[model samples]
Target: MSVLLEVQGVTKTFGGVVANQSVSIEVRAGEIAGLIGPNGSGKTTLFNSIVGAHAIDEGSIKFEGEEISTFRVPVIARKGMLRTFQQTRIYGEMTALENMRISAPEARVSALSLLGGFSSKTDTRGEELLEFVGLASKRFLRAGALSFGQQKLLEFAMALMSEPKLLLLDEPTAGINPTLINGLIDRLKQANKELGVTLLVIEHNMRVIMNLAERITCLAHGEVLASGTPDEVRNDPRVVDAYLGAG
Candidate 1:
């Protein structure tokens, strides 16, 4: 598989604190890659840097062989790359369908236009995605009224509405129950396989990531400690001592 997203010697700092230090990794096209680390290990910081949630202190981020380290979120998103937060970012007062419509790449042109009305194409896609995430019945319900797991599903669908080429997901199963997590995992796999979207996921749930990702990269103390296939990373003594052991 050819490389789709690449991060080389990336670093980020907050005041005196070094959140990420010279990290490098790659995600190939049409593959699921996992990022894992202990608490405060700069997992989310790396995600933010990749998505342009903020600027990096150093290094390069490339998507589809193009430099994007300096690009803003909207710019990167328009290039068919997008990210979902650990916390679901949905409009609470709006219906799920409304949230989906507003999340479209075109909706950023004018909030008023989105609020006023959407074309039939947008409406049809919104409802289809809602059903895709198994939230068809809740499409008309207020976003905030949905359960945490449901909210995450809604956020996933919203991201899908943009037809991204690569998606960076931050702890997708974080707050979900075991049963829901299984369902979510299935949906995530479906999204990757059926929709042909590439995924780079940050997750603390070992079982989930092991099953979901084709390759895994482990970070500790703001640096990559190990990276390989699931079994290789899982058995690596360094990874075990640094992250899996502590977990």
Candidate 2:
């Protein structure tokens, strides 16, 4: 498969602290790539730089063969890329379906906040996506009232509403109940297989990452520690010492 996203020699700093230094990785089209690291390993910083949430001090970021290191978040997003947060970002007062509809690129952010209005087409697609994410029954509930896991499901559905080509997920299973994880994993794989979306997921749950990712990359102290197939990365001494065993 072709490379969908390429990040090379990237570095970032805040004040004098180096958050990421000379990091490099790639995500291929139609594959689930895992990113794992210990706390403060610069995993999130790398995601920020790739998605244009933060400016990198150096190196290149390419999506679908074009350099995007200089692009801002919206520009990158418009190019069919989107990122989900570790903490679900949904309007607390909005219903699950409402949250999904307003996330469309053409939807006016503030207008939706006040009116909660959506087109019939957007509503239909939103409802379908909600059902796909296992929240169809809760479509009428306010987002804030949902459990953390349910809120995350809603957030995932919202991102799907955009039909993103490359979706960057940050710690997707962090606080969710373990029992619900398999269901979420199945949804992610279905999205990748049926919808043809490329996923770059950051996850700490060893079992989840091991089973979900076709390839795995491990990071430590702001640098690439290991990268390969799931078993290869999982068995690497550096990875085990730095993250796996610790987890």
Candidate 3:
């Protein structure tokens, strides 16, 4: 597969502390890639740089062959790339379907225009995605009322409303009930296979990432430590050492 996103020697520092130092990784098109690292290994820091949540100190980030390292979040998001947070993001007061409608890139609806803002087309697609994430019955329920797992599913559907070509998922299985994770994994696979959305997931759950991604990259101390398939990465002594040291 062709490379979809490339982060070459990227670095980021907060004040004087380096969060990522010479970190590099590549994610290919049409594949689910896993990014694994222990706490404070700069996993989320790298995601922020790639997704334009913050500026990188050095190096390059290219998506679909275009340099986007300097671009801001909205601009990058408009370019058919988007990301989901570990903590779910939704309008707590809004109903699930209402949140989905507003999530569309075209929505731009004001607080006063809530019910009248969405067109029938947006409504239909929103409902379909709600069903896709197994939230059809919760359509009219307030987003904040949903359980954490359900809220994450709602957030996933919201991201899909934009049809992102590449979706960066940060700790997708975190905070989710173990029983719900399998269903979440299935939805992620379905999104990749059926909707043609590529995924780059940052996960601490070893079992989940191992099962989800075709390839994996591991980072430690803000640098790339290993990169390969599930078995290869799992067997790398450097990777094992990093995790062990983290604990």
Candidate 4:
């Protein structure tokens, strides 16, 4: 698989504190990769830097071998990448279908375009994705009425509306009931295998990441500590020590 995203020697700081220090990692095309670490390990900071949420203090970020370190979020998103927050971001007042329609890049082309109409094709696709995420029955329901887990599913479908080539998900399984986790995992796998969307997932759930990701990268103190396949990362003494010591 070719490298889809690369972060080399990336660094970011706020005032005197360094949130990320020369951190580097890679995600390949057509694969689900996991980012794991204890709290304050700069996992989300790395994602923010890569997605142009903030300016990096140093190093480079490349998407499909093109330098995008200086690009802003909208530009990067237009290049077929987007991210979902740990807290679901949905329009509480809008129906799930309405949220999906507004999420398309075309709908966001301009402030005026938002008031303009959407095509039937977009509506059809929205329903398809809603069904894909098991929210078809709730398509017309207001987003705020859904449970937290359902809102996350709706957010996932919203991100898909843009047909992004790569999706960065931050702690996707957090704050969900254990019973629903398996179904969510299945949907994630389906999205990767059927929709051909590559995923870079930040997950604190050890078993979930171990089962979902093809490879895992672990961070410690804002730096790359270890990266490998699931078994390799799970058995690595450094990873064990980091988690244990954090405890």
Candidate 5:
């Protein structure tokens, strides 16, 4: 597989505290990769630096062979490296369809125009995205009114509005019912298969990660403890010692 992104010696620090330490990882095109770690292991910090949510104090980030460490959040997002937070960031007052419109970067019309009323182009795009996420029936409902699972799906749809190439999902299945978990996973799989989008997921849900990820990277205490296939990671002594054992 082709390399989609590369992180080399990436490190982040806030004052005297180091959040990430010489971390290096890679994602391949058209593959679902997993990043698993204990809390405060720098999983999210590494992801933030990659997506320009946080700037690295040292090291470099390359996407598709081009350096993007200096790019801002919007700049990186425009380049097709998009990320979603663990929390669903949806416009609560707006209908699901309208919430999707809010995330449509292509809608260059005035924000005041939207406050008054949205354009046909934005409305159409919103509906299309809602349909894409299996929320077409709920399109007219307020985002806050929908069940948590539905809201999560809505957020996923909005993130996909930019037509991202590499999607970084932060703990996507953190808090949801088992029934909805499968639905979310199915949508992610479809996104990868149908849209040809690569994915890097940070998840603590071992079953979900093992089922979906092509490869897994394990981190502990701000360092990569192991990197391998699911089976390999499951059996690694270091991984067991660092993460899988009884606490």
Candidate 6:
């Protein structure tokens, strides 16, 4: 498989607090890699640094063999690297179709032109995308009117609008019901299989991460405790010490 993302000696510090300490990892094309750690292990901070939300005090980040440590968030996103937030950010007043249309880069012109109303083409694409996330029946409803799981699905669909090659998802299945969580996993798997999009997920749910990630990276106090296949990492003594305890 082709390498899509590389991080070398990445470190970020906030005065006395070290957020990420000499971290390094790579994500290959068409793979789902899960990152797990305790609450303050710097998983989110490292993600923020990668996406330009925070600057790296040291190290470099590369995408498709090109150095992108200095690029801004929009530049990185335009380069086919996208990051989704742990918290879903959708327009409450907008309909499900409208929400997808807003982030659809290719649909921008048609969407803006139909500011008065949605055109048939826009409606179709939006509806299709909604259907992709099992939200087709809710297309006409307001985004905020949907349940937490539906909103999460909408957020994923909106990210798809960017046509990303590498997707950074922070806690994608968090705050959702168990039934809907499985659906989210299946959708992500389908995206990876059909679209060949690479995924790097930061999820706390052990079972979810284990089932989805081909390789799992465990972080502890801003350091890598273990990195391996789900089975290996799950049985790792250090990883267990860091996150799971003897049981």
The best candidate in terms of lDDT: 4
Residue lDDT tens for model 3, 125-231: 99999999999999999999999989999999999998899999999999999998999999999999999999999999999999999999999888889999999
For residues 22-118, write the lDDT of model 2, one tens digit per residue. 9999999999999999999999999999999989999999999999999999889989999999878889999887788778756634445646555
How many pairs collide in each candidate, listed in order?
A: 0, 0, 0, 0, 0, 0
All candidates: CA RMSD (Å): 2.1, 2.8, 2.5, 1.5, 2.8, 2.7
Query: Of the candidates numbered 3 and 4, which has the greater lDDT value?
Result: 4
**Candidate no. 3 TM-score:** 0.94
What would the TM-score be for candidate 4 when compared with the true structure?
0.96
Write one digit per residue (lDDT tens) for candidate 4, span 167-205. 999988898899899999998999999889999999999
Query: Could you estimate the TM-score for every candidate?
Result: 0.94, 0.93, 0.94, 0.96, 0.90, 0.92
TM-score of 6: 0.92
Clashes of 2: 0
| Residue-level lDDT for 100 in candidate 2 | 85
lDDT of 1 by residue, 1-247 (tens): 9999999999999999999999999999999999999999999999999989899999999999999999998888888998999988889999999899888777766557556566899889999999988999999999999998899999999999988999999999989889888888888899999999999999999999999999999999899999999999999989989964655
1 or 6: which has the higher TM-score?
Answer: 1
Model 5 steric clash pairs = none
Total clashes for model 5: 0
Span of ten consecutive residues with least summed lDDT in model 2: 108-117
User: Mind sharing the TM-score for model 5?
Assistant: 0.90
Candidate 6 lDDT over 1-247, as tens digits, reads 8888998999899999998899998898889999999999999998988888767999999999999988888878878888888888788899888888767655444535555654576567677778999999998899999998789889898888667899999999999898888888998999899877899999999989998999999988898888999999999989888765544
For this target, which candidate reaches the highest TM-score against the unseen true structure? 4
